[model samples]
Target: MKGIVQLNIVQFSLIYLLLLIILYIMKRSKINQTKLLIVASLRMTVQLVLAGLILTYIFKNPHPIFVIIYLIAMIAFSIRRVLSKNKGINRNFKIALSFSLAISGLFVLSYFVMAVVQVNIFNPQYTIPLAGMIIGNAMTGVTLGMKTFMESIKTQRNKIEALLNLGVTPKKILLPYVNNALETALLPTMNNMLGMGIISLPGMMTGQILSGTLPTTAIMYQIAIMIAICTSVCLTVFSSLHFGYMTLYNKRNQIML
Candidate 1:
């Protein structure tokens, strides 16, 4: 099989022309997202290019310290992004969010690298890319779960107060919201899994196939990664919600948030 073909600079630049279609649609729809789209596109391009350069250097150097530092940076950025989206959380909730993302993400990552892939966890090529995918998905999951849970609590504030007056435990009152949030968080990943290899080709498998990997091998890897991603998402969201909801009440069983 032939190796993957690299696109020249001109060929790659041509792809930017596709953005014109989105711009035209926004104009016709009278939407004001043109500036936002342009900014997002530019940011994505610059970030990916910078990441590519950094990864190249790390791959060549191949040190345990590089991998550890990279993973730390990724987790920190992910936690910050999640928290930034969720303003006004209490200190305990913030701690829960941080620990949940870091612990669940690292646990799944370590297991995937050491047990499933059977590679040195310090191998930047495998660990870094896989860590990005795993942690990114976990971040998204936690964000969605937290958003849904918080919104539900806000909207049902009266119902919660009524329940509390009726002697209902906070756990009984909040458990449903937690469950709903978790299900909402898992839906996207579960739906994507349902349609894999049929409705669409996922990025990792497609990239591997293009790089001349055996189709069967790529399929196995894709399946394994998807399972890992789902597990990471579940564990992170579960830990965050379970630990976080406790903070909403005090020792007197009074609702705080």
Candidate 2:
């Protein structure tokens, strides 16, 4: 049977109303947060409605090209999010991060859905949602990592130049900044893993149980997703750094960014 919680729209609406009440009472932040909240809610509802219709049609078609096209769209959306998050970054940095996220996300996700699961047909049902998760997480990692790295290097341009004058390699001079950026990027993923079951109910696992999957099955998928997140995060961070550093060092191997 479909779980009873799925039909409890009234109860959910009550919680939403209570949240709105709390926001109204708080009265902090100079911006019109209440209006923002209302607009966000409306947009969310419309987006979900459209997504449901599109996904239904996609599943019926069952074509590999279209599934991949949807994945590309998701990745593009994610890149835009990254660009917005790190405002004022160089244009080349944006392009580098985009390529890094695309490559790293696709590599990890393909391994998960193809080699690990070995599912036939590979319909949109399994591919799209999981790919979205991987892409979203990887985008965060790449963007944060690249943005932080750029800021750190730019701020420490003097140190980098001194190292260059001292005949140190570009990568060697940037080592500390790169390491810190990677750590910063991975911190949220680590936090999520640490607090997975206790502090927050993850969306995918909660949905699975709500749809009648056993508790154990939900936990398994959650575990797999966490692993995939880590994998994707690491790959994206390294790739962005790997290629991004190239633009900074010139033909004479001097630090230039």
Candidate 3:
């Protein structure tokens, strides 16, 4: 397979016109979000350009320390992003959430890279991109699961209290909310799996193919990535919710909020 053609600066700059079309449509619709759209577009470009430079250096270096640093940075940034949306989370819960994400995400990432891909543990080319995919999906999953679980507990406080009065264990009372949160968190992944290859070419698979990999090989990697993503998401969501719900309780085992 031939290597993909690289996009030059002129070609890249042309892509911004697409954003202009979007802004024009938003204006026509009176959405009042043109400025927000422009800002988001600028942020995306700046972030991606910086990421590309950093990744280039990291890829060339290919050191275990660099890999570890990148992984930690990804986890830290993901935690911050998740918590930013969920204000006033307790310190203990925040710690638990970070722990769950790091442990579950790294475990799945390691297993996929070593057991499935059979690459060097710190191979930058494979590890960094794969880690990004796994951690990125897991972050989204944790965010949805945590937010839904917390909100449900608050909104259904009266029902939870009733169940508590009936001698229902706190764990049992939380089972329904936990179940709902997991479903909400995993639904997007499930839908993607269902539609993959048919409805859309996934980003990873497309990138691989464009980079001169065989379609069959790219498909294999995509399948492995999807499995790793689902496993990491499930583990993170379950662990985070389990530990998080405990924090929502007082010393007397009553609901905190």
Candidate 4:
């Protein structure tokens, strides 16, 4: 069915109504979430509108430079967000965040596009959106892993030192918490993958179908995108753990935590 303007008004109304009701319930429950609702609404509008315009340009241009600039901006923004939320972390985390994420994320993303998907021109049409998806997933995993790793070290400093004092290597001593942090970091991406077709159709696949692609084509894109997300997130979290641990521990092998 072709789109209808009046139908969109009704759909938007229902969506906003549900959202506002949830916000009100959260406020009544003393959840301190007033700002979240406001910011979320504002962000949804600004991001979608900007994305719409940019995508139009990208679809026309499809330049590699545009793709690079976009991905770089995304990586920088994601790094800032991670650092902002987890303040008081070691300074070296800046280095860890850059190298670990850049190396692993770019590795997986490049291979996925060139080796697997094999789109013509390797254009922003294909690269930018998938790059955004992969980088965004990696950002979440990196932030969660670093945050969890740092906090775990702080909270379990006693246990860690005890193990180390008993002759356990730094790697072995930190392995448990590192594993836990990686698992926690991957949970959201994993959960989305598990719920992909059952609970909700992913935005990319749904959008493709809405724009008149065949079901088979849409499904292929969705599966490929999902695997890319999984790979980037896993690589990011794993690499960040090793990098983060090195930054936290001192030359004497004592944890700074």
Candidate 5:
């Protein structure tokens, strides 16, 4: 098979013209996202370009320290983004969110890299991109779970208080909400999995195929990564909600939120 064809500047720039169609549609529909669309497109372009540069350098000068630093940065940024979306959470809740995301993400990523891929953990070419995918998905899952859990608690405050008065344990009362939140968090990943071959081609598989990997090999990696993502997401969301709900009640067993 031939090597992947590289797109030159002109060819790549032409893709931006497609964004004009989106902008036009948004404007005609009176959607207030024109500025957001433009800013997001520009930011994505800049970030990916910078990432390419950094990745090129890292790939050339691979070191354990560089890999460690990159992983830390990814986890830290993921935690920050999750926390930023969840305003007014307590310190303990913040810790839970950060801990779950970092721990679960790293654990799954480490296993996927060292166990499944059988590569040195410090191998930047594989570790960095895989970590980004795992950590990014975990962050998204935890965010959605947190949002759903918080909203459920707030909306069902009266029911919770009633349950508490009826001598129900906090764990028993809050378990359902946690379960619901987890289900909500897992749905997108599950749905994506359901539609894998029929509805859409996943990005990782497409990239590997484009880079001249065998279709069978790419399919295997895609399947493994998808499972890893789902597991990471499940662990992170469950941990966050499991530990997070405890923060909602105190020693008196009264509903705090």
Candidate 6:
């Protein structure tokens, strides 16, 4: 196979024309998001470039300590981002979320890296990217699940109270909400699996193909990654929802408002 075609600076710069067109259309529509769009685009460029540099270093070094530390930072950042969206959530709930994400995300990541991909656990080139994908998706799932679960509880307080008064257990009363949250959290991943190859080519597969990997090989890797993502999402959502609801009650079995 021939080497992959490399883009020149001019060619790469042409992509920004699309962003300019978006800006122009937004301006014509009087939407007034020019600054926000510009800032977001700038941040995306800067962050990805920085990540590329860091990842390159990590790949060369291949140190397990660095990999471990990076994973911890990713989890910490994800937990912070998830908790920031919900001001009403307490520190205890934050701890639960951190624990849930760390456990679930790591479990799936370990299985994928060690068993499926069969890469060295400390191999930054393989482990880092796969871990990033799994943890990122799992983080998103936990955020969605936690938000939906809390909202369901808030909106269904009367029903919950009535059920509790009728001698229904708290867990039993919250089962429906748990189910709803899990369904909502997993919907995006499920939809992606359903639409893969038909509706859209996922980023990883596209990257692999661009880097000269065989299409079939890229597809196989994408399938494995997607399955890992789904499993991690399910585990994270279930664990977070199960522990999160417990934070709503006290030792007396009374729900906190």
> Which candidate gets the maximum lDDT versus the true structure?
1
lDDT of 4 by residue, 1-257 (tens): 44323446567667777777888798789999789888989899889879879889877877777787877887788778877877787778667777777777778778877888776435777777777888888988888887787788788878987888898778788888889999998898888888988899899988887877887998998998888888888888887777777676676877665
**Candidate 3's residue-wise lDDT over 114-190, tens digit each?**
99889998998888888899999999999999888888888897899999999877878888898899999999898
Report the C-alpha lDDT of model 5 over 1-257, residue by residue, as the tens digit: 67799999999899999999998999899999999999999899999999999989999998899899999999999999999999878889899889999999989999999999999999999899999999999999999999998899899988988889899999899999999999999999999999998898899999998999998999999999999999999999999999988998888886667
Instruction: Give all candidates' CA lDDT scores.
Output: 0.95, 0.82, 0.89, 0.80, 0.93, 0.88
Name the regions of candidate 1 deviating beyond 4 angstroms.
Answer: none
Better of 5 and 6 by lDDT: 5
Q: Per-prediction TM-score, please?
A: 0.96, 0.88, 0.94, 0.83, 0.95, 0.95
Q: Which ten residues in a row have the lowest lDDT in candidate 2?
A: 1-10
Tell me the tens digit of each residue's lDDT in model 2 across 1-257.
45635547686667667666657675765455777777888899889879989999888888888887898899889988887886665567667878888888888888888877767426788888999899988887877887788888889888888888999987788778878899899998998999999998899998888888888988988999899999899988987777767666778886656
**How many clashes in each candidate?**
0, 0, 0, 0, 0, 0
Location of the lowest summed lDDT over 10 successive residues in candidate 5: 248-257
Ranking of all predicted structures according to lDDT, beginning with the best and ending with the worst: 1, 5, 3, 6, 2, 4
> lDDT tens string, model 1, 94-158?
99999999999999999999999999999998999999999999999999999999999999999
* 1-257: candidate 6 lDDT, tens digit per residue: 45579989899889998997898899999998999999999999999889989898988887899899988888888878887877798677777788888999889988988998887888888788888999999988888888888888898889989988988877778878989999999999999899999999999999999889999999999999999999999998898877877777777667775
In model 6, where is the ten-residue run with the lowest total lDDT?
248-257
- Model 5 scores a TM of 0.95
lDDT of 4 at 62: 75
Candidate 5, residue 69: lDDT: 94
RMSD of 1: 1.2
